[model samples]
Structures are given as structure tokens and as C-alpha cells.
Target: MDATWILRLDAVGDGPRIAVKDCMDVAGTPSTVGCRVIAADALPATLDAPVVETARRQGARIVGKANLVELCRHADGINPWTGTPVNPLDSARVPGGSSSGSAVAVAEDEADIGYGTDTGGSVRVPAACCGLVGLKTTAGRISTQGVFEFSRTLDTVGPLARDVAGAALGMAMLEPGFTIAEPPTGTPPPLARLRLPDVDPALDAAIDDALRTAGLQTTDVRLPQWRSWITAAKDLASAEGYWAHRHLLDRSEHLEDRHAGGIRQGRDFTAAQVLACRRSGRAASAHLNALLDRFSALALPTLAFEPPRIGEVRRGSMTYLTAPFNLAGLPALALPVPRGAGALPASLQLVGAAYTEESLLALGAHVEAALAANRR
Candidate 1:
């Protein structure tokens, strides 16, 4: 119930191996999207999704199709039909989803990198849980063509890897010409430390310590509309997700009742409700974008708290920390910082202006280097 892979290639051969989340189409492979109903009638994809095609063009081998939360609806990565990917760092904890298996594959060293989709922190949450580097590129930065749809408005494909360097490499393969620019003089870029309410105080302290250890200059930034933005994004994603998977309602018997019920709620949302979210999302994006203009990136915790054990997951908590940036259509990178000798690390997230992934990765790599130095 914790973790299990969906499918593996017959032969991966040489070169970098990538484990793709089953939601993305791979030539000649079934993209079951971790749903038994879809897999039961699935056929091999005739062509790779544009994102997967980039990986193939870069000579990366597809090692397997990673499992995910059923319908990509849950954050706990518990798929009743397909097993969830175990959290390599701590099996007792939930491997964040819907990109759960992608994180597991990279954390377990079974693949050089894992390609995943983050529509509400699907990539970043799992990366944080598994102690890997996950990047959620700005909306539309990486094409989602040929990939299974869920929240077409919010879904963005990205990479999850073991470290900052590996993450950058993964991004390069995913988007030709994507590069992590070095700091002007090998120092971390200026960061705007966001002050969010109601997060675990310990995690907040850990973030402060990491920034201090990195000697990264930061200014406290507070947002008054943070909660509203998160709520609007969640509703927007649900509405869009329903439209993308509405056909599944015909075979609702095959899905878990909870998942089906959520979709049904989306269907019931009034057009006015959906429109209000759209307007609020844009306003939220503008507010964040203006802040990014003053600072290179906005820094925060990827998850409000560390992942809880399976079956104890506090649903919506992880997504609450991650989905707002997706609403802003900004790039975010999550990197793990050591918590203690044997403690689960806390992930630091850096969100950048639209299409500023290069800056975000540069900041992440610097923070990573700084944390390593402090550890030594």
C-alpha cells in the first residue's frame, strides 16, 4: 500500500534511465494514469507526449512507468488499483503524490531522473517527502501535449532528481535550452522569505536555519491574500480536472467513491463559482508577480510540515502549501535540507517569476551547496 511500480520496460539499455509518471504518454506504452478502469481498456500510445519525446530525443531511456494516486486526485499517493511508490527516505511516511512513483524511482536510484506533473504540488510534495530535487516549471514552459489531462489549467510537467545538479540536467532534457545560470559571483541570489500563518513552527525554524547557514540574504515578505489564493486555485483545478476526466463518470463504479465524489462536486460547481476563481487566480498571480519583480525568487517551505505516515496523512495540507505558486504560473524548485543526523529533511521552495526557472534553479543549487557545507 505504500509503494509499488506500475510497469517497467523490457530493456532500458544504456544511458540515463528515466521513470515517467504513468499519466504521460510514452510510445508503445499504456498510460493508465494509475487508474484500473483506464488500464483495463488501455492501448499503447502511438506517439510519445511532447515532453516524453524530448527525453527520447536527448537519448534517455524509459525504464518504467511510475504509479500515481488514482485519477491524480490525491496527495497521499495511495492508489487502490496500483500500489503507491514507497517513500525511500522513510517507508512509514506517505510518498507525496500524484507523482509518487517518480520520486521513489529517483530516490531509490533506479533511474537517473523522474519526469512528473505538478498541478498542486504533485512533483514538489513527493520530492520533498523523498528528499529529492523537484522543479515545477512556469505554466506552459514545458509542453503537456500527449499527456493525460487533469486540471489542464494548472498541470505543468517537471523533473524530480536526487540533487540540484541532477535536477537541472533533467530540466534540460525536458526543455531544450533550459539551463541553470550561475550566480554572478557564486553566491545565492536574494530571496524574499514569505511569512505564512499556521504552518508547523519547527519547519519554519528549519527554513530559517537553512537560509542562515547558506548566508543567503532574505527579507521577510507577507501576503494578505495567501489563503484566498490557495482556495481559488484549488477550486479552479477541481473545475478543470472535472472537465478533463468527466468521461470517467460513465464508469464510476471502477473508481474509489471518494475520487468519484470529488469529481461530481466539480461538476456541480456553478459557472459563477468557476468564473470567480478565474478572476481571483489572475489577481493572485499579479500580486505574486509584482513581488518577484523586487526579488529574484520567493522562498518558503515546500510543505507546511514533513510527510506523515501512511493512513495518517492530513489531506489538503501539503497541497495547500504548494498550489498557490501553480496558480501564479510561476516556477518553483524544492530542495531538501538536512534536519538532523537521522531526521527527515525539510524542503525549501524557491518560487520565481514567470519563465524564470533558470534563476530559481541557480538559487536552489546555491542553497544546496550552502547546506552541504554547513553539514560538513
Candidate 2:
């Protein structure tokens, strides 16, 4: 595998640093973003994206640009222009994507942390698949200026790493003044679990064992409107995406494969459908916020299945167990669980309230430590 595109290993500042998905502008670097058509026109950005600038100010170096799914269209991490990154834990399986290279770079020890964009689980999905920790901060918690827009409503900048503390360190750099609130000096708030319908049994068991070993209390809660929540996300994203990229789609040949099809479909959405979806989104946000108010955070499987074989994901049979949070603009952390058979990685997502990234990291650190101890 040509790991150069994925690793973006550059020694800048003092030590080495890694670039994020190509969608993010790195001064003077082409933002191909996995599209051959845009590669020629891709210009080196004059100003660093806000997040990138922050990293630089903190002494982090900009390595190379990471690979991503074409136009960041799918979660499966496929890019015809740039070959997909091989999962470090299991090369035969995908390193779940859109932030594909970022996850691989971190997993392969090419960098301490890899910056990534998460719009509908791009960061967390790859983190889960690659057996690393990922944080999808609350929407707008981190600046997105200079990063290519996918769906403005859902896009968020985050980090992928091997553990919670590292993720927290990355978050502190991305979001200035970030500090993980220390847990109260007594018993921590009980953990909350959302029972997802038809979730893989093995995934469920793994989460249970993880929680038990961490000595955290767990409770089963239900969110019956989760399906509706997902639909609203798709609808809103499609409408916004269509508008954002309508011009590119007009010149069909110039559009990238991952984006072309989706953009075309979004362009066809009815005005009424878009309006209804937006309305539903507002309502869902209120409902989810109310539910989250009752617990410290919600927990679920990061993905519905084990990481898929690299080539098999092309068939698009994978389930998206982690996309809802992106739509709701909530914070989510993907923490790796114990490796199952075949040495494949699984993960648990800790969903937190908006602007509560510190709490999420604190909780994730506990779970991460417990999992590490169990492996010993």
C-alpha cells in the first residue's frame, strides 16, 4: 500500500504531525479530497483552516494530507483516486472511512493524532474500525472555516487516537481552553445505555462486559424515534448538500464519483420534503436533548458489525449505527473494546450533550483504561 497519501507524515515545528482528510485546507497544499476532477483545480490554500492553524500554533506539524472516501460520500473508506487505507489491526478489513487515512495514520503510529472531519460518523466510524479512540465534538464546538463543506449543518472537526487521554489532548488543541472536568470526588454519575433494536448480539455483549469491568452502573433506556431522527438527518443533509454542490453537478463530468450520485439525488428532492425534514429535525433535537438531560451520556455500539473486508464494503451492505449523533449535533466518543475473534476491533460510542466534550472524554478515559486492563 502507498501509505504516503494516508500517513501525511511530515516533520514540522519540533516533532512529526499528520494532516487530516484532504477536505481540510493546509496552506499551499492541494485539497484533492479524493477526487481526480478537482485535483487539477485544487489550489494550495493561502490560509490554514481554523483547526489546522490551531494545531500549528500549538506546535503540531503538518505532515501530509490523509486519504478519504471520494467526496466523503460513504462510511466504507473507498477512494478510486487514492487507494483506501488498510486497517492496521486487520489489513483485510476496511479502516472505516471518509476519515480513512486519518484513522490509519494514527493506528499505524505514523502520527500522534490525525485530524479528521466527522459529518455523519466519519471520524468515529473509522476510529472504531481501526481500534482507536475518536471524538466527534458538538457541531460548531470547533471552527470549520477552510474545511470543505459536506453538509454545513452536520460537519464537525475532531481527532482520532489510540486512547482517551490522547484524544483529550487533541481536543484541547483543537478547541482552545478545553479541560476535561474532573469527576466528582465521590461516585460518578451512573452510565446510561440506549437499547438499539436489532443491534448485533456480540456487540451488545461486548459493551456489557466493558461497562461491568469499568465498574460503572448501567441502565437501559429507549429512544423510539431514533429512526425518524436518522431520516431527518439524511433529508436535511441532502437538501443542504444539493445546494452547496449544485454548480459542480451541473458539469456532471467534473464531479467526483462519491459526490456526483448523491448530489444528483439531492437536487431532485422536493421542496415539501426538505421543509418537512427540517421541521422534523428541530423537533428531534428538542426530544433528544430532553432525553440526554436525564443521563450523563448515552452509550451504544460504535458500529453494528465488525469491520468489513476491504473489498467487501464496496457492496454497501454495512449498517450505520453511529450516524444519528451527527444529525442531532451531539458529541460522541468512539472507544475501542476488546478484540474479538479474527483480531477485528469493535467499539462503543459514548454520546454526550452538546458542548459537553470534557465530560465525554472523562467517561471515555475510564472505559478505555478498563478495556486496556482487561486485555492484560
Candidate 3:
């Protein structure tokens, strides 16, 4: 099980054990975004990323550097350099990326919690694939000072854990000065379930049954022009990603075809196109925010389908439903649910208004507990 650790640290703390993505700076170590090409010439980080430093201060043990898609450019956990981390749930399937290793570490109990950066559904997709709780916080809510920049507009640090509480605890530790209000106690709050075309029937049914068991009322909502918004967000991410790594695309001799292809896609957009995309994205955020005003949270499938075989992922066709939230800068959580007997795990996503992570997590905790009770 080559879980893709650039460096493994000695267990040195009594607090929550953590596996941080290789993209995050770790003081003395060279922060490699799991790319051997760049890692060969990478310089050691003089200081820890704000998130990693805070974790250490709070007594969280830093276990190792987790693996990820090269430059975090791919959603499918396939890398040409370091081998992809095997999905602990099923060896035949892709583990999901670009936060693949972090999710794997937490899923396999190698770490109590793991940290991953979400540029475009990186953290959430892997959590869904691995049956873990993943939290992608509101952009800029936590500092990104020591992490590699992928898409400046969409990148955010997040946590992956076995349950909501572990993830919540990790988030609290990472943001030392920020205060998370107490979650609403007792039964889960009413949720707004997003009704989108193209969602898998099995995933929809799983979420519906889970919500019903949790005693949470679901309101069906179809955001107008949703598909256009998704496209706009995709364009914006590509533009920003291209800008972040254009030099590598232009001159690096060690570029992988998949990684280079993504960068080139970003390069194809004109400045005007990117601005138009951002404008469209902002409009979408407002539209979603207005709809969210009437409900405690927006629920939907984390991904449209179950994890595909390692080589079977159809990059453009496999929908990553979580990306829109990143574009909207909303706090989103992925909660695992049973798919069926002898099936891969499916996940339900709960999205809340920006900075409402506490409430959203509280509701998730309630639902998780309720589902466990129902199973018994």
C-alpha cells in the first residue's frame, strides 16, 4: 500500500492524528504537490502553512505527506510518477482525487483525520469514494498561505475524517482564532434537496432514504440555469489554473500528458472569456444563496455515480457535483451513506451558506447518528 507519503514523521503528539496533503507546507520539508518532476527541484518550506502550524500547536500529530494527482490537476486519482493510492474500499476502482491519499489515510485508519485542499471537488469526491466525511470550507475562511496554488479563485483547505465530529474537530484546530458557534442541538433541521437532471437513481434513492430516516424534511428545488452555471465555473477554474502553472506548461520538460492537457485547456481561454465566466459565477452564487435562504441546508449527491474502475473514469462525463459549491465559495460537507448490499459507498452532500459550517456540520452529525440508529 504505497499511500504516497513524501515524508513520514515520527508520531509525536497525543491529539488528533493527521495526514496532510503534500501540497501543504511542512516547515523543514519540501512541499511537493505529489509530483516527482517538480519535487526534484522543490525548495524546503521555511515555515509551515497556517493550517499545518495550527494543527501542531493544538497537539495534533502530523503523520505524513499524503499523495495527490499531479499538481492537483486531475479529478481521477491517476498519476504517472508516484503510483496512485489504492482505494481501500475497492482495489479495482480509482480512489478519487486530487486529495486521494489524504482520504485514503483517514479511511484506512492510518490517520484519525486528514487535510486536503479543494480546488475543484478534490477533497469531497475522494471522501465520497472512500466513505469518509469531508468538509470544504468557505474560500479564504482559512488561510492558504503555505499551500500550492492551483486555482486561486477556487482553492480552499479542508478536512476528511471517519465522521462529522472528527472533521469538525480538525477544522476547529486548523482555524485557531475563528470561533465556530455551537451546533443546534437535537433533531436534524429541515433540508433542501436539490433536484438535478443526470443524477444516478440509486444515489438519489440512497439520499432520500437517509434523510427520511434522519427525520429531516426535504424540499425539492431546481435552480434555474444550473447547467450554465456549472459550465461558467469550470471555465473560471481552468483559466485560473492555467495562470498558476502556465510556466510549467510552456517550458517544463517533465510535464505529464494529463496534467499538461489541463493546463493547456486553461491556456485556451482569453482574458475576456475568464472575466465573463467569473461574472456568470458570481450571478450563480447569488442565485444559489437566495434559494438557500429558505432552508437550513441544500442536499444532493456528492458525485453523480459510484467510483468507477481506475482506468474507467470518463473525466468530462463523470459529474463532480461538488465543484459548483467551490465556485460559489459555500461551505459543503460530504456525508457517506450505505448504497446497498455489496456495493461501493455513495455520499450525500449538504451545502450551507458561506461561513455557516457549524450549523451544517451540526445537522450532518444529527443525520449520521440517526442513520446509525436506523441500521441497528
Candidate 4:
């Protein structure tokens, strides 16, 4: 499949219109949320979600919906309903999801910017795999009224583009009164690097070299409790997802296979576990904030390794490097850096404090420019 859907943008004079992830509801468009069984009753939304409305008002055209993983659960894109979106950089590799098609649309130049929802690296993972820019905004920063609920606490709508500028532009349109703050052009401050243990060494070296070449200072920071934070996030997600869809599971059999399995697993979460998970979430957030307070931004590999083969994702070996931030409710930007030994695209992730998207995007733009110059 070409994986490109073109639509006439009523607002933009002559600009290209791009496809959106299916989880987002567009008035008069079907939102199966990647379930073939639910595709039949998928009704057109009567109203556009806040982000979509803002984009439309700002001259964005309504393009067809993009494809995604079933229920927006998995990191590796394997939508049994619509099939996985092809990773343009490497056809055999998975197009990290559940925002699979959104990233691919931008990577292929089918659209300048693709609207996407990132719960746990959905936007960043695919963008990294496809050699693009993906932004995961702070929780509750962008409105999620029209988007399908996965994990209410973790869900946030963002954008994917081939460049930082494009991503920023898309964000500005979606968010009200968002201003792109320019980074200081002179000698920039040092870029803080987190020591991600158990990550791919070659990927680490490439990113370190890239930061040094960009004239940013690199420091070693340790986050020993990152794993605990991830656990809390998973627990909270399971409980919240179960709450949101339990009724649907009771009344209908429209969920796709993996989603059906997820619903079943969600049902296994007890009320006490759900409350305990929420408590853990709060504690984890507090700890993460303390750690982030010391640095301007934290840097890590977008993924531990390169994109895995599409078939491997179906078997469930690889998850994603981007999920931790979703739980932390921070802003993260993924920028393509260089390929690894396998010649697959690798990316650098820059994470900032909540509502600090302007700063993060500014820093990302500088890093992107520096990388391009180094390549030349």
C-alpha cells in the first residue's frame, strides 16, 4: 500500500492536506480506532475535537483518517484490521505505532504535517523510525476531546513532521496562542544527557557525538527509578482503559483480536490496584519532577535500538523507549540523528518539563540544524 491519502483542504488556499490518525474523530469521517469489527458502526463525529477544530480554523484541510494499531495499545505497529503502516526508511521494519500512518504520511511527503496522538511514544517512535520529527506534548496541554480514549491520564494529541519547524507550526495551529520561542543564537547552554543503562551503545555514541558537534555540553545523569515509573504508568493505563471500555466489552464483540485481549487484561485490574496505581503515578511524577528540575532538558535515545522487523512486532518482542515520558506527563521531541550498524534510522529524544514545549521545540530545531550541517 502507498499509505497516502489526499483530501481537499477547505481552509488552506493551495497547501497539501494530510491524513490524520484514526483515533481522532473528524466530523463525517469514520473512526474505527483500528478495529474492523467496529468499523461498521463507526459514526461520523458531530463536532471536531478541539485540536482539529483549531487546525481547521487556522487553514488546515480535513484529510482522511490515518491507520493505527488496534486500540492504540501497542508500541510496535501491527494492526490486524488495517495492516501495519510500512516504515518508509525500511519496508521490512515496523512503523512504530499506534500513530503509525501519521508518521509515515509525513515521512513520505504525502503531507507536511500529520496530527497524531501519543500515549506512549506513538508519535515519537514512528517518527524516529521514519526519519521525522515527532512531538509528545505535556498532559492536558492540547485538547483531546475528539480523540478516542485509551489511557485518559496519558493521552495527549501532538504532531509529526519531517522537520522541527513543521512540527512546531502544526503545534501552533492546534494549540491556542502557542508562540515559537527562538533559542539563543549565541553559545548555547550545555545539553544534559541521561545515562540510559542497557541501551544500545552505538546509538548512544552517535547521539553523544552529535551533541558535542552541536556545541552543547553533555553531562551524565542517572535516573535509577525510571523503571518504577514505567511500572506505575502501565498499571494506571490498564486500570483506566478497563474503566473506559468495560461497558463496550460487555455489550459488543466489536473489538479487534489484540484489543479484545487487552480489554480482558484490563478487566483483571482490581479497584484497589487501580487506586494504588494512581497513587504510584503521583509519587512517580513527583520524583521525576525533582530529577528534571536539575537539568534544562534530559536526552536519551528515542529507542534502545533500531526499528524491528514488522513481523517481530506481531510476536511482541520489542516495546518502545518513548513510553516512560507519557507516564511522566512531560514534553518530548524526537529528532532523527543517524542510522545504526544495521543502517536503520535512529533518533535522539529530548524531554523537558511540563508545558515546556516551546523550549523543547526550540532546542530540537537547533539540534536538527546542527545535524544537517554536520551531514553536509
Candidate 2 Cα outliers beyond 4 Å, as residue runs: 1-9, 254-258, 314-319
Show the lowest summed lDDT stretch of 10 residues, model 4: 2-11
TM-score of candidate 2 relative to the true fold: 0.94
Which segments of candidate 4 are over 4 A away from where they belong? 1-12, 185-189, 248-254, 314-320, 340-342
lDDT of 3: 0.85
Model 1 agreement with the true structure over 30-121: per-residue lDDT tens digits: 88888878988999999999888888888888888888998888777777678767788888889999899998989989888999998989
**Model 2 weakest 10-residue run by lDDT:** 3-12
Q: Indicate the TM-score of model 3.
A: 0.95
Clashing pairs in 2: 8-64, 10-63
Task: Write the candidate numbers in order of decreasing TM-score.
Answer: 1, 3, 2, 4
RMSD after CA superposition, every candidate: 1.6, 2.0, 1.8, 2.5
Clashes of each: 3, 2, 0, 1
CA lDDT, every prediction?
Answer: 0.86, 0.80, 0.85, 0.77
lDDT of 1 at 343: 82
| Model 3 residue 327 lDDT score | 77
Query: lDDT tens digits, residues 82-177, model 2?
Result: 787888787787878889988888888877788899888889989988889999989888998998888888889999988888788788778767
Candidate 1 — what's its lDDT? 0.86
Model number with the top TM-score = 1
lDDT of 2 at 129: 86
